[model samples]
Target: MDTTQLKHLLGEMTRAEKIGQMVQLAGEFYKEEDSENTGPMHEMNMTPKKMTVSGSVLGISGAETLINIQKEHLAKSRLGIPLLFMADVVHGYRTIFPVPLAMASTWQPELVEESANVSATEAAVSGLHVTFAPMVDLVRDARWGRVMESTGEDPYLNQLYARAFVRGYQGQDLKNDPFSVAACVKHFAGYGAPVAGREYNTVELSERTLKEMYLPAYQAGISEGSKLVMTAFNSLEGVPATANKPLMRETLRKELGFEGVLISDWASVGELIPHGIAKDLKQAGELAIQAGVDIEMMTGGYLNYLNELIDEGKVSEELLNEAVWRILTLKNELGLFENPYRGANSELENNLVFSKEHREKARIVAEESIVLLKNEKQVLPLTHHQKVALIVPEDQSKDVLGPWSWKGEPSESVSVYEGLLNHISKEAIVVKTIDHSKNDRPKDWLDDVSTADVIVAALGESSYMSGEGASRSNIKLPAEQIQVIKELRTLNKPIVLILFNGRPLDLTDVVQDVDSILEAWFPGTEAGTAIGNILYGTKNPSGKLTMSFPRAVGQVPLYYNQDNTGRPLTAYNQEDKYLSRYLDVDNRPLFPFGYGLSYTQFSYSPMKVTLSKSEREQTDKIIVETTITNSGKVTGSEVVQLYIRDKVGQVVRPIKELKRFKKILLEPGEVATILFELNQQDLEYVHQDLSVSVESGEFDLMIGSNSEEVETTTVYLELKKNE
Candidate 1:
């Protein structure tokens, strides 16, 4: 539908009907009989008329079920407007892929895009219109459970993944693409950096810091044409994001150029009352509408008080119309008027959901996302002749599918024991799986460990340990698992620790107890298969850490690109007490960002930086070149990272910032020349006044395999004279 048609439809809608379009309810409201007046309807005082005209439904999907619901909803609609179906399809729908953090660790945005495309295809076929996914929050704290949803700590990498997710979900032409679902980039404007790494905690960041670090990925998502933006649940500067007019209207809509529908995260609009900013639910609705929140999800704040606010002149009719207009326009853009059932077909859902082809893609993604953290004396790639003992401290067969997998069946996931059997002969490998909560070790556990030539410990947090409202003060392996590892260390056999987790952990104690450590973060449906492939050398581990692994829990919010302190700790001042160094623990992380291991080794030549012109414009590019050689005896892939350090700036600059990176496959003894081009925008920083500008100065251009290890060369940026 065009603007003229949308305007005509908007004019025809009554005040109640228009307001209804701006409210979203859960699937249960529509699925159950409304005449009963029970459950959510009774709690929210919602009327049957309100349910009939609601613009959108979330937390439900199924081709047949949605088809029935849509038919009933259209029957009651005065204008026959279709209901939009949205769900939290964060990682995958039916065929679960690796969590977003694991996906980002691949350092391959193209693969991430493919994974998201598969998710969109499966979701659309199941009758979902929007997926609240590609959460581009910049996470530096592992204690925050939602870190599993974000890309990583770096703004540049997050930006790449954000665009990839948007493109994958919406496809090239959303209006004509029935197999694609509209992407909703979520938790806009600093939702990741909560205080104490706690869920829904307050975020206090300076405007400059927020713009420089937290806002880029969101801007990247909007620039890539994501159809919807969900507000964060946390408050910024004491104002809840759902009710912050300056943030939603000025920063997001005006500055970020996001003209799409802005929806509240779950019941964040109603949460404004608890936030102490709004006196009651009525004021919460008033403030939310005033802040330009187009849709209130799972809340009666908008439905119960929006009309009253308009009647009392607290909220304008123009605001209500604009909000409803955006929602209607989105529905039109999705081609819902022409086909309310978008891609709903039971036959297609059965044929496409968790298809063999989709599972293969999931396996490939999971394979690439498995990071090899430690390999002492190359104890991995176990020989088939040697007997192996697969000891799992907990029953992790179902736990392989991490959090937010509402539709995924845990029974379908592949366990490490199952994966080992695929590679090693069943007779050569013994398996001992026990529940840690039972406090009962298998009677044959020690006997199995003593006879095995090698031990593989599959352990980590459960699916319930991470992702949203599951934050932990101690981000480490449980005591029982650690004790089991320590006990296994007495066997004097080589131990390989395979971690299935959602976030980077404090591995101070476990690193010493294991000969090899593979960080296999919830490898989705093909978990066991991917681990088996990596373990047996069918696939070399190439995934890098997007988030740093801290040595201790005190370093909760650790990252590579940190600014220098006035009194820095250095080799020259190692003994000084005045320096900014911890007395008990080292300041550096146990493993830095871009840190990973491959079966083969990669050596980098000295970096070379050349300017296109000595004095160049802001848009001119600077070329950086380096050569990487696979110095080891096997074929492998390497993530070559390029970083930059500004000598001086308007504001203090980080010690190192990741500007560009590439994952390249190299044969044994083969060498590849890597090239990266940087521009003035890469050096730009948000000043104290919140204005982005690049200063002309010297920058250290560094290229390496990871953040901590680099070969550096100096380059000067001489800007052209301008008014």
Candidate 2:
């Protein structure tokens, strides 16, 4: 329904009905722990479970329990205001696909989208209505534990992902789609740039970076018909996002024109007191309500004191109703109110949820997303005939998936040992040396590696290690993991480190200690076979680094595109006293943006630029053409990156900005012509006055595999510099 319909429907509602729309209760009463986990969770505190509430934030359970929990909600609440059920379906809910960072490394938008669809399918079958996913925060700092949740540091890439994940979750229509669910674009704004990449740390961003580099993905989600927009935990520019009218009303709703319901991050409303923004709980509720937040999650301030705030006139009834109207509209759009039992399809659950077809797609998505981080000497693609020693953590059989796989079964999962056994014969010797604990040490495996043809060291954080509040102060392999790898390397046996993680870690030593590294971010149920295929040389590894592998933790927000300072040190050739340079290390990042390796080598031909005003049909149009060839022995895929720079702009444009990129798969000795259309839009940059414009003088365009390696040409646009 439109706003008018929502408003009319809201006008007829009683105070309780209106309040119900704004309240989001925790999901504990109906979710049984089943003697599996014994934790102090509020969900387990409820005596007789209430079926219907504002929403259900499932407190960790599997498919059956999640569905039963929702069924109770629909069967109980007054007006049957069909409660919305939401879970952190970050990468994949049950099938446990790769974490966002690892998935981003793949650089395949379609595959990313497909993975989200699979996640939505799994959650929907379990009666979940929404997923707080596709954490589109632009992160430059790897130290931030939440990097696992984001797409990467670049805004443009996140924007592409924002639309892709939304399409994957909820397609053209949502009311009748079984695989679709409303994708709640999260952390609203500036949550990724936390100080020192610490959890819930304050962010201080310049206006230009926020708009150009951070906000595009959020806006993209809004345009893609996102039904809900979640507020972030951190404050933006001095205002807590839960109560910041400028961010919630003026910017998000007014300027960007998003009409969806505004939901707060967990406990962010009452959190205003800690941020020093609100005097008390009542004030927190009043400010957030007036600022246009429709649904409050966890913070009891709203459910308890909002009526008093309304009576005091601190929050207008109109403002409250507006929020209620938006919330109700979303519920209706979700088809919850029309048919309260809309999602409780027991028949569908019997057919779907981990079905063979769904599992097959999970395998494909998992396989493609496993990025080969390093494969020096072309040592990978191990033979089945060789004697193999698979030395992994004891949890390897269980945590083939890193995180968010409560509904996923490891029995259904293909482990490295099982996969190898399925593919190889008795002639091949496969040894397994697994000791789950890091403290006990795997010293016995050191001798095992020397006798083996190759060593596969599979290690990483147990899925629960680095997500949400799971941010770490130190981003490195566990001590025991480091020790095991160090010992294995002494054997001079080929070592492959299979990394299972939710985010990027400081793996500099691992990069050097092993022959190759495969980043299989919680590779779901099909991890075993997918990984086996890569090791046995069936699937060529095409994944690249989405976030950089920093040389050290001190290099927290390092990236390729940086600005030139007043006294920028000239490379290693120039001597400097105290310049904008690191005394201990080079200012350049360990790996530049768009850096990826392939099994086969690819060569970029010299670039050609045509500058006839008539040929381009516009004086500002600059077209660049380049040829790329697979110069090595095997088939592989490469991302052709295009960057542009204005020789002189009103403001200091980035040294170079990513303008375009294309993922092309090539067979051995294949050559293809790649053309990038250069328009004035491609040349746009944030100016001194805070507007995007194309400054005309000399614009240099370069095409290459990564940022540093470039083949270039120029087309000077001698037009009026945009104001």
Query: Which candidate leads the pack in TM-score?
Result: 1
- Models 1 onward score TM values of 0.98, 0.92
lDDT of 1 by residue, 161-262 (tens): 999999999999998998899999989779999999999999989898899999999999999999999999999988999999999999999999998999
Score each candidate by Cα lDDT.
Answer: 0.90, 0.75
In the predicted model 1, the residue pairs found to clash are: none
* Candidate 1 C-alpha error for residue 403, in Å: 0.6
Top model number, lDDT: 1
Per-residue error (Å), model 1, residue 79: 0.4
The residue ranges of model 2 lying beyond 4 angstroms of the native Cα positions read 1-8, 30-80, 425-445, 569-578, 612-618, 719-723
**Superposed Cα deviation of residue 668, candidate 1 (Å):** 0.9
The lDDT, on a scale of 0 to 1, for candidate 1 is 0.90
